[model samples]
Target: MSIWWSLHLRRDAASVPLARRLLLGTMETAGVDPDVSYDLSVALSEACANAVEHGGDTPDGPSEAYRVTAYLDGEKCRIEVTDSGPGFPATRDRPSIRPARTDAEHGRGLCLIQELADHVHIGNKPGRGGAVVSFDKILKWREDAPLMAV
Candidate 1:
């Protein structure tokens, strides 16, 4: 069986943990391995944090909300976080992951997401204005997993 969920969340710091908890709960209930769940949860938090911090028309004027979607099917789990911000720069339609400076406290979220997930896609929301960060990872099931695919 496959499980999926989506949330329209406020672009606030508190919303980040809510999304992570939901993902972790879904993974645990579906019998995903603990390590896999941890990776996904961390990645989700980073994506959500980015949506809260940089997801806005102006740097100081952040968007009011963002969306987070998750899907667990067969042997993989996919998660996407989108925000109604100005979106990535036009020159780089698909922004490349760049390492954060050693002294920087921020800018590490995107890189962390890339490290955790098997595949990631970062781009803008076509006609509408927003940023989209989606990622997926191959799941590992526990020995006695109830929802493991046959």
Candidate 2:
């Protein structure tokens, strides 16, 4: 069975946990292995937090909202977070993705997402204005998972 969900959420700090909780609940319901679920949820949280922080504000003001989407199909799960802020810098001008300075609290979210997910893509939405952070992992199911039996 395949499953998917999406949310259009306001760019607020509170929305971070909301997205993470929902992802956790869904993974639990689907009988995914706890360790796999935890890793994916943590990555989702980082992506959501980034959207809430950097996903808004045009010259006029904050854009007001962002989007999160998750998909579970066969042996894989994918999640994407999108924001309406100034998109990432062009590739030629973009800084390399790396760990933040040890003394820095900020700038670590992207790194965390990269470390958790099997495949990650971060870039601006084509023909529009926003950033998209997407990642996916190979899912592991619980021994008694109904989906596995199906």
Candidate 3:
């Protein structure tokens, strides 16, 4: 069975939980294991929060939006979050994920997403003016769950 969904949301704080709840509901309906679903939800939340906080045009310009897409196929799931802010720093400018200093209050979203997802890809949107963070995970279903429809 395969299912997919996409959301175009304003780059606002409220949109974060909206995306998370929808993902959670979809995973639950598909009988994904609770632990897997929880991990994915946390990763999704981090991605969305990043978009809301950093993925936008200049503050004086028009409000911008972000995109979230999720695909569920059999025992695998993939999710992508795209934001309209300045794309991620150039490849050479990105630093490896590391534990933030104890006094730091930020810089952990990407690291958290990386830890939670099995595979992650971050880069600019091809030919577009935004950044994209994509990830996938192998899903585990409940033993008694019914087969999901494609």
Candidate 4:
């Protein structure tokens, strides 16, 4: 896995899919397993959507210029996405799944992120414009779980 990495891009609702793909590619390039890369894509997408829907309207504020950065150490991977809007502490109250129902596109992103990431943190960005979602992939797993030995 790569020891260092980063990505920055403008925030536009239309760019959400692109943002996800970019993050996925970055993780893959860093030698992450494909399933792990896909998980990061989904997590970043959910976090970005929150920034867009709830953060400020300024450029880079969710609907504005959104930036996502990801990196890996020997045992873990982490991602941080920044947007222009500001928010209070985030709750993992990401909504539940209803896979059989169509037209139910509004929620479910954070919920998925929360489930996949070994650890997740949400907070306001250090600067004036936005917030960040911090996620980590742990080095170890439950006894019966599959291993990501890469």
Candidate 5:
């Protein structure tokens, strides 16, 4: 099935809930298990949040415009949040793994995204025009339980 709706909005706490409701409903209609819904929601939220914070649109503050595109194919659902800015920061200068310290009030979104999704990828446009963060989650494929001897 394809995405029912694709929305673009400003990056903010308010946007998070709206995105969650839409994704949850879409996943359920597509047959996603309830037990794993929260996981998917958390992961997607983190990805979007990261885009909100890192996506250069918010040069001074939260960028008023950011693109959020959701798509579903087969048993997997994917989302790509992009920003109109220079792609990922150079690896040497990028520190998305962890914040400066535990007490730091910022960071950790990428870490959450890594834990929530089956695959996460960050790439830059061919001309370094913008950045794209793709998130993919397996909604229906789970490892089979162990068999017991009869």
Candidate 6:
């Protein structure tokens, strides 16, 4: 069985948890292992939080909203978070995961997401002008758990 979902959310802090909770519920229903689900949830939170923080308008006016998409196919789950902000510096200028400074209280979101997900891809959204953070993990389910009815 395959399951997929997408959310178009405003660039607001509250929207972060909304996305996390929905992803958790979906993973739970699909019988995903708790540890795996937790990892994915944390990664999802980081991605969504980044979108909420950096995926917003320029000085002129508010930009378009952000989007999150999740797809579970066979034993793999993939998630993507795309924002409508100006996007990170040019691809060549950005590092895969920049280490946060010792005294810094922020700038760890991308690094955390990379650590949690089995595979991660980050870049700007094509033509639209924004950033995209995508990740995938091979899922493992509880042995005794049954798949949810579609």
Number of the predicted model whose lDDT against the real structure is largest: 1
For each candidate, the alpha-carbon lDDT, in order, equals 0.92, 0.89, 0.86, 0.66, 0.67, 0.87
Measured by TM-score, how close is model 3 to the native structure? Answer: 0.90
lDDT (10s digit) by residue, model 5, range 1-150: 454457887766678778888888776665666656678788778767766666664244434656777776666678887766555766664325543368877777777777778887776655635677777887663244121111
* Selected candidate, larger lDDT, 2 vs 4: 2
Over 27-51, each residue of candidate 4 has an lDDT whose tens digit, in order, gives 5555566777777778878887776
Q: TM per model?
A: 0.95, 0.94, 0.90, 0.68, 0.74, 0.92
lDDT of 5 at 135: 79
Candidate 6 clash pair list = none
* Candidate structures ordered by TM-score, highest first: 1, 2, 6, 3, 5, 4
Question: 34-118, model 3: which lDDT tens digit per residue?
Answer: 8999999999999999899888774356447999999998778999999877777776754356667778899888889999999
Better of 4 and 5 by TM-score: 5
Candidate 3 wrongly placed segments (more than 4 Å): 58-63, 92-95, 148-150
Model 1, position 78, has a per-residue lDDT of 94
Candidate 6 lDDT, 1-150, residue by residue in tens:
789999999888899899999999998988999999999999999999988888888555776578999998888889999988888888565546887998999999988988989999888867867888999998898875577333
Task: Rank candidates, lDDT, best first.
Answer: 1, 2, 6, 3, 5, 4
Looking at model 1, which ten-residue stretch has the lowest summed lDDT? 54-63
* Strongest candidate by TM-score: 1
- What C-alpha lDDT does candidate 6 achieve relative to the native structure? 0.87
| Candidate 1 pairs with clashing backbones | none
TM-score of 2: 0.94
Provide the global lDDT of candidate 3 against the true structure.
0.86
Could you tell me the TM-score of candidate 6? 0.92
